[model samples]
Every structure is written in C-alpha cells, then in structure tokens.
Target: MALDFQRPDPSSPAAVASAQFTVSRRGYREEEVRDFLRQVSVELARLLERERFLESELKALQARGPVDVAAIDEAAVTELLGAEAARVLTSAREAAQAMRDRAAESAEQIVRDASREATRLLEESTLEASRRRSDVSGEAEQELELAKQQGREMIAEVRAYRERVLTDLARRTEEARRDLERLVHERERLLGAFERARHAATDVVGDLNEFDQSLRGTGVTPPLVPPDAPPPPRASRSSDTPIFDANEYAHELGAAHREERTHEVSANDVVAAEVDPTDLGQVDVSVVSGSPATQTPSTDETSPVEPSLVEHTPVESSQIQESSLASEGSQNTEVLPTSDTPEHIAEVVNIFDRQRKREAPRATPIHDAPEHPVFERVEAQPEHEVVAPVTNRVDEIFARLRTSNTERVAKETIKDLVEPEKPAVHESVFRLRDEVVTPAVESMTRALKRQLSDDENAALTHTRAKRTSLTLAAMFSPVEEHTQRYVESIHETITSVAVDAARSLSDSRRADLRSTVARGEVMEAISDMLSSDLLRPLHERIASAIDAASGDRDALATALRSLFQEWKSQRLSIVIADIAHFTYARGLFLGCDGATSVCWVVDPNGPACADAEDNALAGATTPGEHFPTGHQHPLAHAGCRCLVVPLDK
Candidate 1:
C-alpha cells in the first residue's frame, strides 16, 4: 500500500503514532520514520520561530533607544544601555517563565485526557473480554457435551456390534450341535431298519428250505402226519428221545416204499464197500440217529420220530442253545451217517476216534424252531418305533437374530475400528492434547486474566472450566466401563473448580466474575482460540479417538482408559491450578481482606524451577497462615514451572 507523505497533517503526532510502517529484518519502518522526521522538523520550525521572535525583540529594544551616534553622554548611555539590558533580560525571563507555565498547563490537560482515555479503554476491554469469554465458554461447553455424547454413543455402538457377532456365532454353534445329534439318531434308525429287514429275510429263507425238504420226502412234517398212525420210534439211552419216522407218516406209500428200497440198496453198497461184499447182505444196522453205534436210516423201517408239537423242558432248551453256539463257533465239521459206514464196525470205528464219539449237534425240526433265536430276539417283542428326522425348527430359531445388510455393514465398521491404525490415531490425539491443547488453553487463560478486571472471576473461572471441559471432551474415548466415567466426571470436576475459584470473592463480585469470565476479551485472540484451539481441534481429536481404537477390544479398551485417565489427571491438575491462580488474582484485585499471602503451588516431589528465586518462595505463604487475608497469586512464568495460589488463611 502506498501513502502520501506530503499530506497536510502527515507530520502531526497522531499521524506519527498511527502510521503503518513496513517492518524489516534489520531496519525501522521507512514511512513511519519519515513521518516522525517531519514531525520533528515541524517542532524545530516552531522553536526557530520563537527564537527569531526573541532575537527580533532584543534587536528592536536595542534599536528603540534611538541614541545618536554612540549616545549623548557615555555614563548616561551606559546607564541607559544597562537599564535596557536589564529590561530585555527581565522581559526574556518573564516571557520564558510564562511559556513554561503555559507548556506545563498544556501537558497537564493532555495527561488528564490520556488517563481518561486509558480508563475508558480498559473498562471497554474488560467488558468486551467478559462478553467474548461468555460466548466462547458457552459454545465450548455445548460442543464438548456434544462430543462426549458422541463418544459414549460410539462406544455403545461398537460394543453392541461385538455382542451381535458373538450371538450369531453362538447360534451357529448350537445349530451345529443339534445337527450332530440328528445325524447320530439317523444312523441308529438305519441300523435298526437293516437288522429288521435281515431278520425277516432269514425267516423267509428258512420257511422255503423246510417246504422244499417236505416236498422231497426228506423232512418229516408233523402237521401232515396221520393221527391214527402208530407212534414213531424213540431212541433209548441216558434220556429217552423220540425221532420222526417219515415213512410211517408219508401219505404216498408207494414213493415212501421206493425211497426205502433205494436207501437199502445204497446202504448195502456202503456196508459191502466198508466190509466184505459177500457179507454186506448179512450186516444189521443200528437205528439210533445220533448214537455212535447207530448206522444210517434202517432199510427195514424209517427212523423213529415224535409228534410235530413235541415240547422240550427248559433244560433241553438251554442244552440246545449251548450246543448250537459251540458247533457254530467251531470250524470242524460233524460227519453225518453217509450210507457207506459198515454197521458191524461202526461202534468199533467210532471207539477208535474220541472226537467222533462226542455228542453231535441236534437236527431240530424247522417247523418247531423260531427264526434268529440267538440275536434278533425282537421277533417275540414289538418292533422299534420309526424315529422321525430332525425338523428345520432349530435352523429357523438360529436365523431369528440374523442381521440385515445395513445392520451388518454397521457392525463391520465397528469391528474394523479395532484395527492397528486406530491406536495410532488415539496416540496422536493424546499428543495433540498434551502439546497443543493444554498450552493453548493455559496461554489464552493467562492472557484473559491480564485483560480482565479483578471483579469478573466468575466469568474467568467459568471460561477456564469450559475450556478444560472441551479439551477433555476431545480426549475422552469410552471403550470399557465408561473409561473412567468420561462424560459424567468432567461436568462435576469443572463445575466444582469454577465454583471454588469464585467462592472466595464477594457474592456480587463472584456473580459478576462468572458473568464476566463468560463474556470478556481482545476478542480476536479469544475467538481465534475458540475456533482453532478449542473447537476444531477438540472435535478432531474426539473423532480420532472415537472413530478408531487400539489393536483389538482389549487393547482398544486400554487405549480408551489411558486417554481418559491421562486427560483426567493432567488437565484437571492444570485446571485446578488455573482456578486457584484466578481465585487468588481476583481476591487481590478486589482487595479482599481475605487475600492473604501467596504460596507456590508446584510439584514438591520433583525438581522445581520456582525455587530458583528463593528456596522459601516455592512453599512460603507471606506473613503467616494465622492471618485472614494471607493469600495471593504468584504466576511467575508461562512454561510449566510454578503457579502461585494465594493463601486465604
């Protein structure tokens, strides 16, 4: 921008003072310097004018005597020159004194005007600061509250997502268990069906075989045997046993007689081959079927038998089962009378081999025996009820809680928040809080304190508390158990702090301070701080922490806890210090009788920079704690060193 240096009032003091100048690395502003030089030249011109007036007066007075050529008398002219010299000297002294008086009067008026202007500006500044602080504080509080709400909501959402996932997994697990049970049931049912079908087939095959035997006239069917027929022959030894005579029971006498003749021829061939051929016709066969001494069925008569309904005692049934099991388990075959054995030598031959003499397996009638008497005993009992397969009811139940795509997407986002990058974001927010947020809040607060009057501590403390709250809201992330009760705790802590800071002041002043703290500033700094330092940064950090997490749930939970607790302790302590200082400063400003000596409030456990001035200064309360107004604030520096809280003893 260009400025006209030759303007009418360019060299005026106001112009000189208000002039804008180009700042340089190594030199003063050229325009301001030039304007100032013009002012100096103007002042020099006035001084020259005054000097010329005094000199012209002196010359006029010297010329005013009008002495003709060196005066009429030497003594008289000398006396006249002396008087004139005295008069000029008197006039100059009087005029100089009058000028001094007038200059002093002008200076006094200027001082009074400047003082009034300064007071007006200060008051106006205080009111403006109070108003700005009030607005900023309120806005900051609402925003902080909103951010906290969001943090809490986000926490709830993520947790609910995890729960849903777990519930889905559990449902699937239960469904799988039910399916397994159904499978096992089906297997058992299949085995049961197979056993039933096999048992039925075995019974059918046995009936067929018996019918075939009866047709061939080899099996004795008792139901077909005549009731009037002579009783069948019985084998005698140890226990009397009846054996069936097929020839006696046969209705076709001719076929029976022919079968007997054929058996006799075959029996003779076997006897002749075993003994001498000439002696075969004279050989007599024993009729007992199972006896070692017995031969093949006698040609003279069919083998003896009992009725078809022959009932055995319990002992006989047990014996039959034991014999069947033993015979079935053994690999050796029992030889039946094959029509070739000599009857005369049968007894002597069997006596020679002990195994042949052993009791043989009984030839039980197929008509009397039950099918599969050994294992499939269910034939006599009821059959198993068919088990129904598992229904789809369980699957439907499992699917009941299934989420829709939109809900699932939300869930995925929540679950994905635990990715590794989340914690890094958290760490960044925390870093920003520690580095940028805390210092900015404190710096702005200190600057506000400088601008505000002593009366507006309520506003001062309110603003401080609000700023603290906003910072906390930015830093809080609720992951586990409210993460040190983030939202709930901040309001109380900050409120108590604000109250405590203003409590020591008078009721009216307290109210005014609160209102003022809520209102005041040089506004640009306050507005800029709220927008840049508090609002934008707080939400960004809140977004960073809430929208993300640590590695996983547990780690994320830890991150949340660390963030909250860190903010709680560090910022709270600083806030308390700020309030304490503000309270003391206000008391001092109010000239409270209770505003006593001050004490250095710093970490006594660590090396303190505050003690550098005086070892006593770090801890000492001025005067004594015994005094009522023994407290004051001694904020010595901006860096983290010491804040002096006035002791209100």
Candidate 2:
C-alpha cells in the first residue's frame, strides 16, 4: 500500500524529510533579487543621464534661428534709409524759404505799377481844363478865368487829399500783403516738414512689410512689433538731466530706482550719521525765509526744489504782547479824542494803568528741598526655587529612580509619600560615581586616542580624529557611574527575590524529591536564568555571589544550564504596554560619543509614537505578555514610558 507514506510517524529518513516539507515551505531568499534590482537601478541612472544630455542638446538647437543673422543687416539698412529721409526734409525746407522770398518781391512790383497809373490820370485832367478856357469869348474868358481859379483851387485841394488817401491805402495794403505772405511761408514750411516725415514713415513701414514677408517664407515667427516706437531724441550736451524718451523713461527709472533702493538703506544711514539729532528738533519749530503766511497756487514746472520748512509761532505769548502794545496805542488815541470826552478819556487811561499795576509779577521766596532718585527700590522674590534639605530616606531612595519611574509613583500613590526634592541626587551621584569611574574612563579614553591616531595616518581617515579629545572625554563621562550602579542594583535585587522564591518552593508540601534532586532542581532554574541569551550579561554580574557559595562543580554547571533554559522557556514573558505618553517629551538628546545628536526618538509602531525610539529598552521582560488581554495596565499608550518589571521565580 505504497509503504503507508502518510503515516503520522515516519519509518524512514526520506519519509520523515517529506513530512517536514509538507509542514512548511521554505521562504524565498530576497537578497539575490535585491542585488539584481541594484544593477537595474544603475542601468536606469545611466539612461537618465544620457537623456538629460540629449535634452540639453535639443534645447540649444531650438534656441538658434536661420533668419537672425539676416535680420541684423536689414536693421542697419533701415537706419540708413531713415538718415536719407532726414536729409531730403532739410532740402525741402530750404526750397520753401526761397519760394516765400520770390512771392514777397512780386507784391512790391504790384504796388509800384498802381502808383504810375494814378500819376498819368492827373496830368490828363489838367490839360483838358486849359483847352476849354482858350476856346471861350473874352467876357466868358474873364468869368471862366475866375471860375477856373476857384475850380483850380478846389481841384488842387481835392487832388492833394485824394493823393494822401491813396498813398495811405497803398501803404496799408502792402503791409497786409507782407503779413499774409509771411504767414503763407510759415504754413508752407510746416506742411513740407510734415509731408516729409509722413513719407519717411511710409518707407519704413514698407520695409517692415517686406521683412515680415521674408520672415514668414523662412518659416520663422517675427518678434512682436511695438506700437509707434519713435527714435529717441538727441540730448543737448549742456543739459544736466540725462536724455530720456518720456515713453520709455518710466520703465528705465523703475529699474534704476530698484537698483538704487537696494542700496538706499545706506543713504539713510549716511543722513543719520551726518545730521545732528538736536538740529532736527530745532528745524521743526523754525520757519524758512520768504515763506508765505497764507497758502498760494503752484505755478509751472520750474518751481523751486528747496525742501519746504514750516514754523509754528508761540501764539499765546505773541497775542499777549500784541494786546499790550495795542492798549498803549489806544491810550494815546483816547487822549486825542478830537474835541469831546477828553476829560473822560484821561480818567479811563488812569483806570487802565491801575489794572496793569495789579497784574504785574509778584516776588516769591524760594524753599530748597533735598533731591531724591526718581525710582525707589522694591524687594523682589528670588527667581530660582530654594532646594529643600534631604531628610527622608524613602524620598531619597525614590529620588535615585529615573524620572520616568518617579513620575509613575507620583501619579499612582495618594497623598505626599515623598517630600519636594532638592537637586542633590544628581550632584551626589556624580561625587560618588567619580571615585569609581574616573580611572577606568581615563584609561579607556587614552586607549581610544591611541587607536584614533593610528587610524588617522592615511589622508582619507585623517578627519576621523578631528574631534578626538572632545569625543574621548564625552564617551567616557565619569558621571554615568551612578546610572551603572542603579542598573546593577536593580539586577541584584531581582536575583535575591528569585532566590527567596526558589527556597519557598523547596519547602512546599506537594512535590516529592530526594534532597539532592530537589536542591538540583532549584539551582537549575538559576542557571537557566543566567545562561539565557536575554539575561546572561545581567545574570552573570548578580550570580557571582551565588556561584561562590555552591561547592560542587558538576551541580553548579547543571544548575546554571537549567536556570537559563527554564528562565527562557517558562519564567520570562514581556508585556508591551503602549509607550504613547513618553512621546511628548521624547528622550534626553545627549550624544554618547562623536555621533550627531538625535534630538528625538520615534517609536517603531507609527506616527502616534513618533517621538519614541525604534527599539527602546524600557525594562527587560520575557518574550510573552504577563497580563491578560483585559488586565492591561493604566499607562498602556504606545509612548507611555511605563515599563514592566521582571516577576522572576
């Protein structure tokens, strides 16, 4: 029946081995896979580096343009065209001026021709009158001659007046013509200049259009064209202010001001150093010369740039003085009261004089009193608490405990079992501890210094000895002797308690044993406790006394072996209460050797225990829980700082 392969008890080695395999499979060895992953990571890093290089090359190639070189030459050509347009405008202005001079000469010729025509008409009228007088009879001639003389006188007077009016009219007309001609010349010059500027703009616009076309054909995007960006005006050399195009000046000034203000703090410092603080106070009270009493409207841009100052007159004193002078002037007026009430005015003046005398300053006696300091001293309480004396034994005993344990007793116990402590424990511990730990610590420090010096001979290792002295002193701190004593004391106490428990079990009524056998069993538990890996170091230190008392070597060996085995298998069990409370304070951040200070210790559980250490040793306990599930302690938070003490047998 196939050799009964599935039997509970295997009869052959191969069958037994098959049963073991059936019970549990072997776990995969992850280290080989992890090593493979490392190689993959290196390959990925190399690929990423190559990609970055290619990406940089691509960006550089993308930054270049085929049209940029041509664009620069085009820009220079455009500038030359602009210069030629300016030259043409200058020639046009000169031509306009010549045309204006010719028009003025034509106006002068028109005035001269009108004056010659008037002279000819006057000569013809005189000859016609003479011929008419000769043709008439003698009587008629005499009458005619008298009439002629009267007519001649009237005619000559009329002609003389007409000539004066004509001459005046011609002079006024010529003046008006000259004025109009000058205005026309100015208009022509302005029109020509404007036309020339417009043509220059058109030419520039045409070239820009061609450039835009060229850019598009080359598959290149043209830069954005700014609106109406006029060329900057040339500055006159004599001007103090730098030449700035008003449109761009705001942007320029903003940048300049930012740079200046970055160092503007220095200007204020300079001002403070140079200025007298007292002078500023006086300047506040004083008024500048030429300051107007009343406010006035501001004029154009060339207003004075002087810093304006103001003065505040002492109104009360000025008003009092003004009133006194006015009253004196009024007294004179009262006496000269024209013709009436002169007698009454003199009486009023005498009354006023009596009032002034009553208001005069009075003489006073001075009494000197002793000068005293403004601030009087008041008694203050001391800043630090006064440390009480160490009188109670129980308080002193508990003070030797760590802060974590002392706090637990304080929280658990009712009433004041311990007095308020002085900080004497720390001082006392160091004093006693120094006596024991100083020589050992000093020897260890010297040994470490020698090793460090040997290691530092190589260039790469030299830095390791940089803080050798400080490191040695700190690592071998003699003050920790008290802590060592406390740990040893606790271990010894546990050992004594376990011994008593074993002696009690030996005397119990239920179990049967030979005297030798029973003694062997009790000692076996002790040996197991001592030999166990978890407790071996602490157990050896405490077991030295017990070992000396036991006489038999064979019995002692069995006892120690059994003690460790039993203690590990049955007596030891650790209860992991939550350490949540200790999380808040974290641990003391003291560096042991030359390592960096790990300020806080975070618990391994999670963020709830973020301030706890990864594997903090609270108090050593067994491998299993001591308390039942429902019987957990009050301080069970993950970072509580409370620890379970060993309950040994």
lDDT, candidate 2, equals 0.35
Cα lDDT of candidate 1 equals 0.42
Work out the TM-score per prediction: 0.24, 0.14
Q: Write the per-residue lDDT of candidate 1 for residues 1-649, one digit (tens) a residue.
A: 2346554343243443344545554334445555544554555466557667767876897788665665557567456456655454455445445544644654565567667778989998987887666546545655677799999999999999999999999999999998787667655654554455445444433443444344324311122112123445755434222233434434433343466679978976785576554332222211121222433332321222221222222223345456446545542543332355322211111112334324454555333232112111111222368999977987876676564656888988998896332111122222322333344345434443332222123323332343333223333332332222322223333333333344434355555655544442212222332344233443355446544642233333333334433433344345434433333333333333354555444433324553333423335455334212233333333233333334442
Which window of ten consecutive residues has the lowest lDDT sum in model 1? Answer: 371-380
Please, what are the lDDT tens digits per residue for candidate 2 over residues 519-606?
A: 4332333233223422344244225523552544334333333443343333332110121121111111010112221112222233
TM-score of 1: 0.24
Q: Model 2 segments beyond 4 Å from truth?
A: 1-288, 291-299, 302-304, 308-523, 526-649
Deviation from native of the Cα of residue 502 in model 2, angstroms: 14
* C-alpha lDDT values of all predictions: 0.42, 0.35
RMSD score of candidate 1 (Å): 29.3
